[model samples]
Target: MAGEDEIEGRNREDEQMHYNSTNLSSDWPFNATNDLTNTSMAMVASSNPMNNASCSSASMIDSFCQTPPTIWDHHPTNSQTLGAFSDLNMQNNPTTSSSSLGFRKGNLLTPSWPPPNSAIKRGGMFLPPPTATPTMLPHTLSQFPADSGFIERAARLSSFSAGNFEDMINPFGNVPESSMSPYNNRPVQGQPQEGFVNGFKSTSGEGSKDLPLPVDCGTNDGSQPKNDARQGGSGFSGNNLPGESEYSEGGAGGGGGQDETSDEGLGSKKRRRSDQDSDYNQVKRSPQTPNESTKNNTEIQQKGDKNPISVANKSKHGKQISQSSDGQKEEYIHVRARRGQATNSHSLAERVRREKISERMKFLQDLVPGCSKVTGKAVMLDEIINYVQSLQRQVEFLSMKLATVNPRMDFNIEGLLAKDMGVSGTLGFGADMAMAYTQNPSQLAIMQGGIPGLGSSSSDAVRRTINSHLMAIGGVYKDPNSQVPNSWDDELHNIVQMGLNPSSTQNLGSTTPSHLKAEP
Candidate 1:
């Protein structure tokens, strides 16, 4: 009986040890899940039962025990199940406890499944190895792919010095060496490009209906233009500008070539621009010389040359311009002749002279009174002469009168002329003379009208002569009869009467003495 008890104890110990080993192995990387691992361990234990008593005891215990939570459970099985198993297993074997191994608070809440190094095999498919969480990083230019062309261009640009700035910005086809080398067969800086020249010819025959007609800007020197046979391939260079010869030549060649090609079933002359051509164009924007300017201008004019009518019109227009310019340098009135008038040079000269003379006569008529209505040139001349003679007589008479009135010559002539002469009364002249002269004998010749007929200059000579005669007459002539003669009074009265008549001024050469006659 004691031997049977020993065997049963040994069987119970083996069962407890197997249960602990299975629980520990469930946490191993090789296990699929806790449930599958526990099921396999239960089958092994059931297959290896060595004692019936021990097996009966284990069966009774297994019947009372609940299943442990698996790794696949999103939330662990309730802690109440673990709490119930905790009391039975905590005392003897803590490693086999569900709470301590699979259902720990930290493991259940934040479970990391399928370790990073392991692959998950579910059904027929195998999952890729678990990856670590991704992290963000700052971006940089180096992270992108590099372009060789762009890099080389940048390096070349950085290498340029201040001295080469002109080369960089040059706009007349003076491209830099680096930019020009790649495009084969491009023309040099001062030379015209073959492609451009060919293109010019191709387009020349194709009439530019949309473009405006070019203006004729003739050469600086007015010399006649000479034809360049080399420029006009067809040997027709009529009045072309300096560089237009080449343009004409190109147009003739292109037109003939195009015609021949079309007749022979050859291809068209059109060409597509390649990369090299485009690059060349970009580099060809530099400045050009005078020769190049002429070439370009020729190209521009070629399109207009196709139409013979237009060429003829241009030639006609050019001739008109030259004629007009020549006319500008000469001195000639642009006078148009009337139907009845002569257009001869002599007639024109005579008419111009007559016009000048008529203008002078008009001016003279304004100066001379009563001559404005006179139309005849001879009559106007006669009136002008008479008027001048009258002015001369009036001047002479006035000078003589002044000499008599101012014997001292020191009297203020300006003050005397400003006051009224008061010559209407019979005694007016005598009263004025008496007041002016202090009994001076120098005034006697003037009052008696004894001055000689020495012409218009006689008054000036008499005035100067009177200045030398300063002798004073002491006594006044008390006899009024002696002061002025009866003949003198009669003469003075007649002179005054004639002067008062406005009509007497028309003929100063009338019978009345001119010197004695007061100016009308």
Candidate 2:
């Protein structure tokens, strides 16, 4: 009995240990009761002794362990205590148990553990069906209305079935046909239609009665009376032609007579008689006719005169009258004239002068460097003025520079005149000096007075001294023809036709005295 009890106690200990090792908590993702039952069964099976005499007891233990415990299956004495303890644990870890059982606040229908929102209908007797109140879904999902009526109508409309598609695509299938095109078919009145010939009405006899007959259609016999070739073929010198009598009778109420004559003669006689009558009436009624007729007769007589002087005088008077009238009109009238001036001798000469000036200006413009390309006279003049001013400034600057380099050198006018007079008296350099002066007066002036220490002397003394110096330097007496020295001063004067430098005077004075003594 003692051994059995000891064995039983040992087995119970082993079972408890295994149960503790495999026990399930509220965190397990399944039913806690089932987990606990399985863990207890495993503990009983593994902990039971195989050769022990309490095999039946082991079996009973396994069965008891396999039977899952409910919340109500605790010991009778400790039920209330265990229940309180479980309630405390649930309060403490509500999320753990709720998560494990897949129950949440807003998602009672679809729990977190299972695949969400399956097609399965879950409502039963214990749970009422979920009422679908209009919840605001995302815009991406609910672009259309949620009403079933609208959705059904839209679905019907959007359906791609053959009948619906054909109806939608062929909306005009029931339209009636027409025999004619939409454009108008009738021709417009009075307007020329396509492929139709437009004929014009004849206007041959529609002319005004006052209009004269055409010359080409009229007979020449009466309209243009035959000329007398013997009398210079003058058409006016003909008798028995339609003239004053026909015109007077026609104007004086002789309609019957004209009609009879017109029938007897051709259309020419009718036109000529009408024309003569009209002319005679006009001439007889005009107030100025007598004066005009006299003037015309005088003009014809003067034209036929054989006096050359009279003709010439008449022509000259006509020209004078025309010119005087034109001049008076031009002087008084404030009208703007056209482009070119009136043609006359004075205007022609002025035009020629202007042309010549323009040509000369063009030539000058081409000759000058850096001139403006524009052809305006003002612009050309401006550019030329600027260029000349710049050249003058350059010359002044160069002169200043030269003067600074040789401050003792003189360029006085008096000294140049003295030198020129001396050279003319001694060497007869009148032509050469004048030519040099004409070519470059400024340079010639500068060169003539460029000698050193000559600015202090009077014009006469300077002249005499310069002439003697030239004669001595050239080893020549008072002779017109002499061999000149091949000296630097002579070479410089020959090359530039200018005076020698003042510095050469010292060398020339030293050598010139010796050459003078040797020549004598």
Q: Please provide TM-scores, in order, for all candidate models, with all chains considered together.
A: 0.18, 0.19
Q: Write candidate 1's Cα lDDT for 447-493 as tens digits.
A: 32321222223434433332222111112222323433444455444
- Among all windows of ten consecutive residues in candidate 1, which has the lowest summed lDDT? 128-137
Q: lDDT at 458 for candidate 1?
A: 41
Q: Which residue pairs does candidate 1 place in steric collision?
A: 171-285, 171-286, 171-287, 172-286, 172-287, 173-286, 231-245
Worst 10 residues of 2 by lDDT: 195-204
Error of 2 at 411 (Å): 15
Native-vs-model 1 lDDT? 0.26
lDDT of 2 by residue, 1-520 (tens): 2222222223322322222222222112222233343333323323432112123322332343321111112111121222243332212111111111111111111122122111011111001101110110112112222223222222332221221212211211111111000000000000111000000000000001000111111211111100100110011111112322332443322221221121111111222333432442233223232333233223422322111111112333323322433333343122212223432234544666878899998888987786647678998888888888898999999999867855553444434444433434234444455455548867655644554446444434553566566666446446533422333234324423434544333333443444434433
**Deviation (Å) of 283 in candidate 1:** 60
**Candidate 2: C-alpha lDDT:** 0.27
Off by over 4 Å in 2: 1-341, 408-520
